[model samples]
Target: MYNKSHAQMPMDRSPPFSSSSSDSSQFSSTSSSPAKSMRVVLSIECLKGSSKADEWTGDMLQTGDIVEELRIGNMIVKSPFKNGKSGIQKILHGSFKQKETSIRVRVRRGCADLAELQACIVPGDQFVGRKQYVLRAIDDPNYAVGFIDRTESQCLDLQASRTSRMVSALERTPLQDGYVSYPWERRLVEMLSIPNSSSFYSVLFLPKSSDKASARYNDLEDTLARAHTWINASQASGVPIVFMNIQTESLLTKISGDTASSTVNAGSLSDLSNIANTSLYGFEDYHGVDLGVVRAVRLWFSPLAGEIPIEIRIKDTDTRLGFAISRTPEGFIYISSVIEGADDVPSARSGLSSLYKQASQSARLLVVSRISNQKLLPWMVSATGAIRCFDTVSLSQKLSLHRHTRVPILVHVYLWDRSANNANVGSIRARAMSTSPPTPPSTEAHLKMTARGVEEGEEDSDEEETVASDGQEDITIERDTAGEFSFRLHDFALKNNWV
Candidate 1:
């Protein structure tokens, strides 16, 4: 129906149109053109205690405008203020307020040049790279429709592809019955097989238990190795790794010198110094790892374990029983048993402090199990802090995201509490880990230092030589930090450099 010239003419401008008509034409041109279709990402960070939700609006926003959403990314409010759910809905409603200034917004366009896009741009770069701009009504009457532009950064999730490598390589079968259903794990596996181009965040869970048999010691070596491999790969590729420690249970079962089912309540581990430090009956072979670190481990009670004298689990406001959540330096959050009934507020507060210490500090992986009650909802939010949640397929999907988009993939351990029968508690929870990523080059330097020490062990102590990958030993040797054992390996490698 249109003329041939109409199709060939420039699309952004109006031809012989009035001012109002021209404005409509401009809006239509911008909305329909492929040049306005840019990919964007959004992230949220440190969102806690039911604060205000970040909103995005304006019909003029292109595809690539929203890049990242983080807890403490560029876009953040200086103070902690309460926000309602309507904020996000407001964005959907295209309610970019040009009047009451309260929120901040940032927007930016993607690089047009192919080289710049490929050499430095990333999947979430169009959004994450720039500093967040405030959404003030004063800055242009179109404040609500304004876009903030910022710089791009290297995301860990867009660079990994071996999310399933650990799962596929493992020879052990999953615990059929005793194990809690960690949907996070399942989600990670699924995501690894099917990749995405975005930031990946997830958690691994360690169920609460005083029983070492349920500790999965057999899988310990494999699990630890898997974490190492994933962390190593992530570090090599600029991804961050958060590892959570195991949680301990406070509910004890008094044994009648019988089967595993027979038990009693011994009490909470919070009073370990007062508990007589008595050797636990079934825990004779148990090492001090579980009960040692209060920050990394949490405790809870189990109905299946029978009843005992002392009860350590906390009772929530709803009387559904609660437990404390804590963290370790390796990014693991330890969970405790729940306290049901009432009147034990003292123990609950103490346990809560410990849980908060971990949550507020380092934990990245969180566990969700059988405990039920809405009173502990605030606690759950506190534990998550600045972390993200994902299904079992998250890990894999994260790997794929990293591979395709150059984002970092965060690793989390997740567990579900069977004690929680309520449906509203959600499927997964997470905490950040106490992890210190080591530089590969530093590791190599240490290895070389160790090798030199090993070589020195065999040489004439008075006249030793430190040489590179050469046969001639012409360099003088110096020992600063490492001992003789370190040099022994170097001498051995030097002797067999060809191999």
Candidate 2:
């Protein structure tokens, strides 16, 4: 039944080249002129048969025939392929998955002869699978037509390129720009430049081998020591340091059967390091394609130069935290205002008073990095350069509860150094100033409170009196105004909280 289907396989009737037999004679006659190069084509070298070579009978395919094109099912691939033998093997592998019965091949009898022959290849005892056909490129001695070998029942032996091996290693690693450094050597992969700054982020790869019990312990110690060095260097230079460790495995196989696909395995240190200078730096497989097995351990180091860590312990009698918190458009939380002359408040006693005075005089901001041991700074950046941070509303509510319960709050504030050339400071100041909201006009009640002290119990009575005065002013303004009546009405409503 299979033989009948194979025999009925469709073939292309049109020839790839001219059918005129006098073409070779015309080429020999033109030899007196400039010699032209012949187009390269594939040829059948040797076939593996049962006993000796060329044992198969009734087969239309013969040795030394130039392959014109190959067709599997509805898909057809012409000659002079870019990837050569590898490209053909890939097509065969895909066809195997589709369970294709046969493939049609068009070939030329000889270079001097223009006769085209078509043949159908099917699975049998001699050629058990599609991968059994091994093709290789060969140089033509005549320099007229180069030949690429097409054989059956042979294995393909080819080495993967260095870039391919590096790409494979990077895919196996769990983190971007990470590779396993085997044999206990610390190697720098690449240095990524930071925008608007002279400093750079260094990428390094460390290896973790579990072959021996002592090797694991040694790797751990080395990682810790390297982390300490990075942290210290970053602190001393007032910069940030980040590193990730990639753990790689050995001996990974992706072949489902005797034929292997184009999947590359990890290689030696030289092979993996060769990609550092290429354009593949910082390459990541965002699609989650399977390459190999690997593990990642990440470490982050933040600058500690101008950071001030303060712990504020609230007392039972303290009515407020004595500090107002506001967020910039850039999603940074900062101390917008501080209550003055309140020596008994928690903020006054926690040394925030000095910091606030210094910040006010210097016209700088007190950017809060952490509150109550919770980090409030931006932890991630999106592709559009937008920062991700904790919500300010929830943080303010938590701080209000802490003040009501007299709980201590630990805060980490970043102070910008005026003498230093800090790009972050300049960026923050520019963005804050550009996106700052216009200040609202002060109310008459607030002015009165500032002039004469009003107790907490008298606040409601003062508000009632202010509302009555505002109503009388609104009525008087309406009677006296004519052309500017609409503006007066809007101003009255804003002042009396009618809006």
Candidate 3:
């Protein structure tokens, strides 16, 4: 169990432990009794994937030890150190305690701008408070063992909970789907959520330390209101939602002052000793939670990963072809690498490489722009009610409810070539619209002919429809009229010729 006196505990003892509260602002705290028979066995692993991993064994760790992050081995290495002055760390053996190196200082090392820093802390802080130290399932889709930070932040203490109101509210929060609200107590969740090649790091909430309190109850409530609205909207659509405090992953962008080094070079021995310091910008104390939740939802539904194209097939309500999908900011849900694959698929099989050759081998993926008789990319927002993105629920529901010999799923695909510098950056496909049937004209030349036909007294018998464009992919003109045209993708190359 954690205590106010936990700071007074010594290292070299043992861990009954667990642990990010954002902010250099004082972390919030409240203690409870941990379970007698714990399900989560927690420990801290330092310098994972680096030489330091060997040095900082999980068993030797204790609470309050000063730890710094070193970028090494394409990872964030958490190694133990002493503050410039002495610090507190506790170590509790399985059934005993051991003496640890603890020293008290007389003259405090003070900050230069104490007044400015003091203004950062807020009193009566209820909403955006302290960090969460334990994670478990209300119910989970993936195996719980995979996401737990078992090696490092593995177990709950005698009792540990979120110190802030916002943090606690989210802990163990349930979705209609029966999963916990958030499981990101550590980087392990990030690794599982994203591709294996990606690395995870915790963002410091309230990155700045302030002795002075500055939170207004009204403003904090307003922020919560916005987050709540989004959560309700997303839940109605069957996507699990959460309150994200620290943002750990983002699109890797290159900035002038902080150029990311080569993964191999950054992990070198020389670089290991000289770790990069987190800049002030890296320590942003964001006031609102809406943007973070929005990005998280966007990621939850995204399919593309590191520019590689992935394919997904909706087989049933609970069954899928592969990979967790996400919507691009452009509104199209592009496929990413496979996160999961069904053991039994009824689709026509072809070697992936052979399918690639259909597009001259430049294409690495096929994006599903349409499903059955419905479009994934919307042509128009329903003025009557809420906006829909990729009739996602409708697609799954169709598979679950409908009967078919083989589930005639028509998936429209576009080639995603990864060799280009601008990956998923902008609009990559072109379109020409038509309201008539027969062969659904494919060019401006055909559009001209259709217009000319109407002018020349030709009878346009087939019902007319509209397919809007994102200036990228084509629209569906045959969903209702032709009973979902068989989406046989004979061509996979992009019109851009990157193919």
Candidate 4:
């Protein structure tokens, strides 16, 4: 009869078995008696110094450890195979060729306790499971018996694989489980994965779609087309575009503990009353819980319009800047008025008059997108859907300091495009108004501004005054003795109501 007690004996007493040099000899010795169990187990000869060994095995495997079973994913190859060591080698080679990420080996170490070994054994099955046994090499001093921990690299690989599978499933069926989805193309994904590529992109989520004829649906199509065009054009100019989507609920959960479920109950009645109101609080709610969507697409691309970057140097003799600044309701800071015929001022020297003239002739606004290399454009959107921008008061102070210090300022302006016919500006303003909440009177008073420096009581009565065209408003700042304007641009804007 097979001696079960002998098989369970401590491995330290037995002579070292070298499977690499004499697999056949070891198998023959074990198979000598027909009544005895012939288990052809493999042992670790030595581990290679490769990174794969450290990442996949580390100290879990050691020299002279008995490998009872090998597992690759769901497939398990146990000891006592048909061809002994050669069979296990063939299986391992096949797994390597298949590029399997997970490879687990159930090993029995010399110091493993007899009680622990017996406890690890399966009740019904003869073969031991991969996670059942713990190696003494791993839990030496502590002697705690549990499943081996996965390496960091291995954990990351598993997570990446899971995410990939989930994304693939999402791409297959976008609309699933009351969630709208948009999958990024593989090319866009690759582009975005490149280092520092995130800053080049921006995302905007649209409301949920129920009707194809609805304006929301049309807007979505238009936005997609525009983004596509921008990306294509940017790519042509050697700039790669990044387009991506993320789950709104997941984002909200991470940022704030609020889930889509709570908002869903709040908006349920309203959603039932008006099918058009797909969101819990309409489109103005940027939190995105009301959209009932898993993913929304956002695109980032290089500048599409011909943005002219102008460098204006403040000379010692210059007093008046020769231009007025104002912002549109859509958060565009623009040259509202220019002191005509001023030759020595910084604005005229920088050729702002010519650009202003072109803009006037084309019925377009001379918009300043950036000042002193810092972007002055609307940089963020509030939860209430208001366009959040750089405070003009602070910007005026910065400009005033620059003038006092005679520091040069760089500005980026969007030149008037005859082909576009101011359509871009008009569309942006219309879109902002459609989704944005009405600006409170107090807030409007604080933000709106038109600023120009003029001599005391130098009113031009003959200059047919129009608000959009160099018209004198309620607030006027007199030029100081040094010729620098001393009033805050936002203060002027508040009094004039020039938003």
**In terms of TM-score, which candidate is strongest?**
4
Tens digits of lDDT, candidate 1, 1-499: 1122222232223232111101122223333434333312242221111111111112122222332211122234221122322233243223223232233322222221000000111112233223323222222222122222211221112111113322442444243356676777667657652222112232332222344443211222333343344333332222222222333233343332322221223354544443232223233223311222111122112111111112233223322113323222222222322233433543344343333234223321233221211011111101112212211122223223333343322222232233433223222211221233343343234324322211212233433333234553432334322222111111222321110
Task: For residues 169-210, write the lDDT of model 4, one tens digit per residue.
Answer: 447633326666665566555655232223232534333334
What is the Å distance of residue 64 in model 3 from its true position? 99
Q: What does candidate 2's lDDT look like per residue over 69-143, in tens digits?
A: 776678877766657655666675667667763555555432433332232332322433444443211111111
Please give the ranking of all candidate structures by TM-score, highest first, separated by commas.
4, 2, 3, 1
Give residue 131's error in model 4 in angstroms: 40
Superposed by TM-score, candidate 1 places the C-alpha of residue 416 at a distance from the truth, in angstroms, of 26
Stretches of model 3 off by over 4 angstroms after superposition: 1-326, 336-344, 347-366, 381-388, 401-405, 419-499
Query: Candidate 3 lDDT (Cα, whole model)?
Result: 0.25
Over 4 Å off, model 4: 1-250, 254-304, 420-499
| TM-score, per-candidate, Cα-based | 0.16, 0.29, 0.18, 0.36
Better of 3 and 4 by lDDT: 4
RMSD of 1: 33.0
Candidate 4 RMSD to the correct structure: 18.1
Ranking by lDDT: 4, 2, 1, 3
**Native-vs-model 4 lDDT?**
0.42
Query: Candidate 2: where is the Cα deviation over 4 Å?
Result: 1-304, 383-385, 419-499
